[model samples]
Target: MSVEIVTARWIVTGAQDETTPVIHDDAALASRDGIVLAVGPAAEIKAAYPEATVTDYPHHLIMPGLVNSHHHIGLTPLQLGAPDYALELWFAARLSMRKLDPYLDTLYSAFEMISSGITTVQHIQGWATGDLDEVLGAARGVLGAYEAVGMRASYCYAVREQNRFVYEADEDFCARLPAEAGRVMAAHLARQKMSFADFMTLYDELKAGNRNPRARIQLAPANLHWMTDDGLLAIKEKSDAEGVPMHMHLLETAYQKEYARRRTGTTAVKHLEKLGLLGPQLTLGHGVWMTEEDIEICAGTGTCICHNCSSNFRLRSGVLPLMELQRRGMVVGMGIDEAGINDDRDMLQEMRMALTVHRGPGMDHSAVPTPTQVLRMASEHGALTTAFGAEIGRLDPGRRFDAVVLDYSSATWPYQDPDIAPLDALIHRAKTKDVHAVLVDGEVIYRDGQFTRINRESILAQIAEALAKPRDTSEQETHWLRAQVFGEVERFYDGYVPADTPRIPFQQGSSRV
Candidate 1:
């Protein structure tokens, strides 16, 4: 059966021509088999598909659904305002406080994301017990929640192996280690001891369960700074072998770049390039600390970068050189980082932040990204990060009908000129509250400020209960250890160049208290 949606005052299809008007005053979009079949004047569409069921969105502006490239769905409730600290200390506190619960994590984050007009998210799944049963179980729970809430996601089991602190060491460590060794020893840990063989098995299992065509699955290497050289190379090889994209955090902070350089005798981008890991299949998050050479390398190798605006400002990580990256022909996507910083996965808010912040001192405001370009970053550029650019970013004929409708009556009224461009108003002036309807793969998943698929209240209640539980912080044993983390971070930034370097100044209108 064909479904026809009409009554959109304006439809921004995200096509090539910025002003190529496709649907005018009364437009309609028809879809069947989850693909857009037609989009044009309502009268013409209705005449073409007489028997198609019609749904009307009277005073709404319709556009492509948002694509969030990098996000941590499990970190939603941790949105506590943690400012005035560098990246390591802030990360330590977050890792210590935020306990992972599959059900609550997905429920709260998915609901917030969909409500905020983000139809697709690339979720970096958090730490899990190194047991296949536990890991796959957690993955299933998250996938189920996303499916239930009608949100498309590229869910990755974040893989890592690291040394634990002395306090976390077992008593048997005394016999296993030499006298010079501390109470703890570096242990070979895998979230799930998934060899390449085991990972393939688990991938197939998860893929089988993903019935929704819109929900994509991929493997993400957590970060180069976190993983060892062997682990990084293995991840790159595995992703290439399996034909999946590899996502990782890169050059997020100046300290991270310095740390990578000190440890590996090369910058993070150069190190990855040396390892043969910088390629089209890679998507690096938070390219704020990238050098010009690094940007050129990424462009040459076809590697993508996710520019996370909110997290950068909140954590005091420097602003990404977005215009330069675009100029070099790199695919730049937008992300909200983890939940607590941005607070919500609102793509419109992210778009606004990206545009405003990138226009720093001595830069032309007009040279910054327009609302349309920002919209493209959240939609098309984001899709490109996950290698789905050609399939899911726009609402054109033969494409998937993933779209969001904004109520223009209240939010966009009093336009002196009818030709004032609804797209501008939607990007700059609109809020999540204005989102009236959302569709994924031709299915109406959200409407009338409520979800069509999941129980929002139930999910919220579960999250509340999870947050109330007692957290375990026994791992952070000594004040010296805590201080060491912060001190290392501080020292790392000692030689930082705030003036000579390309930097985005803090916004004058920031909500700093």
Candidate 2:
């Protein structure tokens, strides 16, 4: 086992308690065979590992790499020309875009992730079609790209056996549309349909086929409204029996909360509890509309919540009650989801946003998410949602050496002051360009300005070339038809659930200014 020692001015070892990320100065971390062996003062680590090769970063901040807790295909919906619609309408707009090659698509996002110091990502792969062979191939390509980029990815093909678009049956949804638009949607649904049994079979095959340590697979039921009772139970049974972790989207929007009320007569959290799906093994994404009662269930069940602040704001999903949820001892993770305030997958900026957006109007500072808390959500807490668990989120001994090195001079050294904490500076001012190096499994996968494992420039060029093609005529036709039926979808929701109901997360389905 080769031993390597990395010495930096500051080392931020994200919380062991899983809530607060703490910083150490003049630190050195030593690793052997890709696992961290020790972390302490530079002199001590050097003295202890005299035979190890040493790499010094005199003015850098070494920290655990950011973990993106929830992602889908790595492309923002906006790239498809879909403006920030509610989650429901966003789904409709997505049909208008053209699909890219899986390998290139996956690589496109991996580059963005690496550039911004994200070492791990949970890719919730949602499908518009369920052809087993095609899905399996795409899954392999996605995993292959991550392997090539040397990023750890927890993957799950998102499963939703019902309610493809709105919270209604296909026949009912189509009936609400004009005849021509109805035919278009029905045809689309027919192409996308798959038996519940087939989904499980595909998952099993995917699990068996792709065995890369960095590419772990898990179960994800798309959402409460999109799943049937039997589908939920089957997923729960498989997850429990196999001891694999599971994640699902829950109450991402007010409409989803209302849909839960209309379907189950209770909160989505409570509904999951009754179905034996609420447990530490399951992580719920979004969860913006969760009520106090739902928070209790999440806390009691030890379930984790992934807070996608950027996606929520863009999609008009309400702000997550971060303070209340954390106070209840619920595990919270930070995710960029699809896009951030800058409409890009930049973790540093996302961290800043997560810290800022929760500062409610109050004299009590405790209501705000501190830099330490936000850092933990981006690091340690985020790892809980992935298959790596506690192995890769910290720089402590016995953990994988997954870390990012920041150019402290760029963010803090211009006016260096001992009074300001390095952690505070990083969470507040660090930018993606300030990321100097990224390491995975004790190896410097990205350094100085290039990736060691793959030809990033060539891959990106190929992606650009592919995207330059004009949209297919058939796809354009589909886009037009889908747009025509979008109003019908809104009408269906308005007719079934009055717009004035208290269950909506905001007033009139719009964000509170």
TM-score of each: 0.85, 0.95
Q: List candidate 2 segments past 4 Å from native.
A: 16-20, 495-500, 503-513
lDDT for model 1 comes to 0.71
Please state the error at residue 210 of candidate 1 in Å.
Answer: 3.4
CA RMSD, predictions in order:
5.2, 2.5
Candidate number of the best lDDT = 2
What local distance difference test score does each model get?
Answer: 0.71, 0.84
Model 2 poorest 10 in a row by lDDT: 503-512
TM-score, prediction 1: 0.85
Pick by TM-score: which candidate is best? 2
Q: Local error of candidate 2 at 127, Å?
A: 2.0
Candidate 2 clashing pairs, residues 3+ apart or interchain: none
lDDT of 2 by residue, 356-430 (tens): 887766577666778888888888889988888899777788998999999989876568686867778777888
lDDT of 1 by residue, 178-200 (tens): 44232322222222245544555
Residue-level lDDT for 457 in candidate 1: 83
